[model samples]
Target chain A: MFRNIFVLFAASLFCFASCKKTTPLEFQPGDKGELEVEFDNVIGGVNLQLNTGSYTNASGETFKVSLLNYYISNIKLQNADGTTYTVPRDSSYFLIKEENPSQLITLRDIPAGNYTGISFVLGVDSLKSTAPVAERTGALDPAAAGAGMYWSWNSGYIFLKMEGPSDVATSGDKKFRYHIGGFGGFSTPMFNNIKQISLTAPGTSMAEVRKGKAEAPHIHIMADASKVMNGPMNISIATNTTVMVSPFSVNIANNYVSMFSIDHIHND
Target chain B: MINKKKSIRARLGITIAVIVALVSLGVACTKTSRQERKPMPLVLPSNFPAPIYNLSSNPITVEGFELGRKLFYDTKLSRDGTISCGSCHIQGSAFTHHGHDVSHGIEDRLGVRNSPPIMNLAWSQFFFWDGGVFNLDLQPIAPIENPVEMDEHIPNVIEKLKSDAQYPGLFYKAFGEGDITSSKMLMALSQFMLQCVSAESKYDKVVRKEGAVFSAEEQLGFDVFKAKCASCHSSDLFTDNKFHNNGLVPSMVNDSGRYRITLDPKDFYLFKTPSLRNIMKTAPYMHDGRFLNIDAVLDHYDHGVQVNSTLDTSLNKNGVVGIKLTVADRANLKAFLNTLTDDSFIRNPQLAEQ
Candidate 1:
């Protein structure tokens, strides 16, 4: 009877050790990790080369991009288990330039989990856009980070700027310029072109963010430049050479709203 | 050995005394400089309403105001170093471009709108004719970057200041020792602008019961103004700070005034109701400077009002397009308007570029 009891005790101890080893460690309440989102600018599946790459839009007008810059702000990550993690407002604004060496946005101190989707605003929010000059720093500084991207006359940020030469453009220099921005209005209501973008990672590519990992998960996103002129409303360069601070800019904003998509995710 | 030790001790004592004297001298210099930078008081006029600008964010100081005055007069703010803010906003003309219908800027480039005065701006809620710029801090950027105005980028202006021999030191004295940011520069400009209080006018004295009573003609004009014009120009500041359509025939540009900012059809042909504080000095009048004098403006109100969909109801009362002012009423109104000029404000040497 004693031998049988000892044997049962040893068997129970083995089972406990094996069970602990097999189950994955669940993230604790205060556990945190990092995430990176890369915005890859492309024109119809071809990498965008500034000032040299020639591309034709749906209107059959060929154009060469000289400058492209846009604001991405208010980032929020959707956890796989129905929870959302919002980046702090102060550190959320970012300026994505096509000529910049890095378009990767790294979010630190994110709650460690399996993120299934990401969402962000394509332009500065109306509140921050109208914030006091002291409150506007970093990416929103009208003179520094937002020099060319700001409209000093209108007192708002240019949300997206795309300027280049188009053969069919009607302008004297044959340049198609689209400087789109409007945060409603300060005293009265006007054009609000702030677009919200939400992209979900494709099948089998969930961004797994775990603590103590050697590398953080990277969400690769493709921002198609062709969609700016071709999606929803087909913007012909010959017809609309310069669209800025007008009712027509709303259509351009609407087209660019559908420009982003999740290409893949790497959880290395 | 005793004599050598005494000599060494004597030398050490002398060295310590010299160091103490130098340190005190340095402290004295810094103290005087700091005293010179003492914050200037923004004295609010007894007759004026509470200032619309929040002074706590950017406090006024003697150093800051002086720096701003220098920047206001500095030609480096323009593209070709020819036009300063004072070029268009002349102090003798009550900080307006006197006589000119539309102020000319760098390279003799003409702007679309008239150059407004720079008095009592702390009481103003909006900056430009269309009220596009809401904050005073953001107002300078428009003219500094306007193609027909200064035609220079703010960043480039800052760089020029940085490379200057005196501006960097002046900026340091005004806003501590740091990089001269655009925010600091704008705040300094606002400090000077806020100090431009125009409350010493004859109208203000009469209202304040300061013993300076208005003449009989001025009193009659004041009564007429109260009856006909006080609805729009409705405050101690002589402006309700609201947009309205005064029914002037739209210019050839058909400038859709406030509509450009709001993009609302109801706001078409609407412009800010300008303050009447320096009306006697700040002419040609109206947004485009169409009226050459107060009489022309009165004539426009009396018989020259054009009918428009967005015309102010006060101007078009029951299909009557104009205010129907008699010749005598017009003379008295002009007298009352002249009482709004604050002579001391225009001549304040502190506001002039040194």
Candidate 2:
């Protein structure tokens, strides 16, 4: 009986070892998968339709967004097992436009895991903002991809740009322009509006990135446009129509910090 | 056995020596290849402080500087192809828009401020009167994009260069086989501007004891200048490179100067200190070009300083609003200021637009 029990135990150990080798529940070191973070720009729970959608702010001013663009960079994902995966900084920067259909940031070669949380910077970091011009290619290219999103005079990228027409706007064209950017000054300390955003999947709806999966999990993130004028401080269009590099821009930046939230995760 | 051991040791020594010789030969070959592209030397005057610009990042090369010169003189950079960087910044006027109180850009669009001289820019930490641009590599974009200035988009300029018959080849020679990128273009422009060193003035000669001596009156003027102006125009570069409110009244546009850039209340009406080097050639003086001549500037310092919340403390020493000047002091000071004129720098054929 003792011999039989020992044999069974030895056989079980071998089986366990083989099973661990072949059908491991956790991803191997070299295993990689893809993830898609979709930025859905919305205005007060409604899908934002650029140029036609009318939205009212907390200040009771109705407005229509003509254009909207913002930079999302330095993406990081946290695994359920406490391991963190950082997307390579070079491939991390994304400029999301309201008009662009490609709002889905497809993160390729991400280690297969159950990602529980996501974190990113809303604006270009100071280091990239001041990096040598050659390194600033792709979305960060000032003249080409970036275009009007850069402040040529100020020597920095305008992280978030929202322009629209409002009856209450004091500008002659009845347009309010908010060009928010300042990555702590290069030589001296200045207005730093780079906002860090972190969001966790809601209650067991974590993104399950698998190597052989038919489709990558899509993380739906809602960026509310109304938060620009309604967050923390109620910014009235009549009072401030054009806000660029100003002390008041800090308040606008503060309001927009709470704009992003993970609505759902599609692990199909 | 001892003879065999010695032979082995001799062979090892010869092997090591051969490897060292081969490595040195490879290094020499690389050095020869590097010397194929002649490096244009940046002027480092013995009297001046070390330059603020890092030369290692953008080494001045003959081809790159020539390309920059061509670009500087090219009107294609502007929207209408009528105005170039050289149009506003004339080399004869110490690279300033001479006699224009405020420079006019393409289609005679008047700019609000005076065209600051491009001389001694390598020493400058910030560009323009308001210190808006910190890096020299990023300065050209401002004028290129400003509606009143060149009024041309950078991408368009790059496109134009790519199609140009001569530009692509020139760019290739300068930056080596790459599409005409704005980064390479800007670096090339900097290579030319960095060589615009204005340290060959008579004052420099006198200081260096290069057989040039200040006259008695000029010496007296120097003493007065040392007492009154040298604090702001501190180094041999002739500028502290710091912004200050020199007490000029706000213009019709109500230009807030440094406050516009920093958005700090304390920085109100603060403008960068104009360098005293080639000060005679770069007039009318002041940020707005309100003073037409050196005497007007001196007169302003003597009586026209308007007190404000952010006026420079040096101007308000012991409640005296401005520097006091006597008749002899004015004459001698003028004589000393005149000695700062470096004719060779402004007239250098190498820096001229080809």
B99-139, model 2: which lDDT tens digit per residue?
99999998999998999998888889999999998888889
DockQ of all models, two decimals each: 0.59, 0.48
- Which residue pairs show collisions in model 2? none
Q: Residue A182 of model 1: what lDDT? A: 96
Write one digit per residue (lDDT tens) for candidate 1, span B84-184.
Answer: 99999999889999999888998999998999989888888898899988888889889998989999998899999999999988887888757998888
Error of 2 at A90 (Å): 2.3
Once fitted onto the true fold, the runs of candidate 1 whose alpha carbons sit more than 4 angstroms away are A1-33, A208-216, B1-37
Candidate 1's TM-score: 0.89
The B-chain TM-score of model 1 reads: 0.91
Q: List where candidate 2 sits over 4 angstroms from the true fold.
A: A1-26, A211-214, B1-36
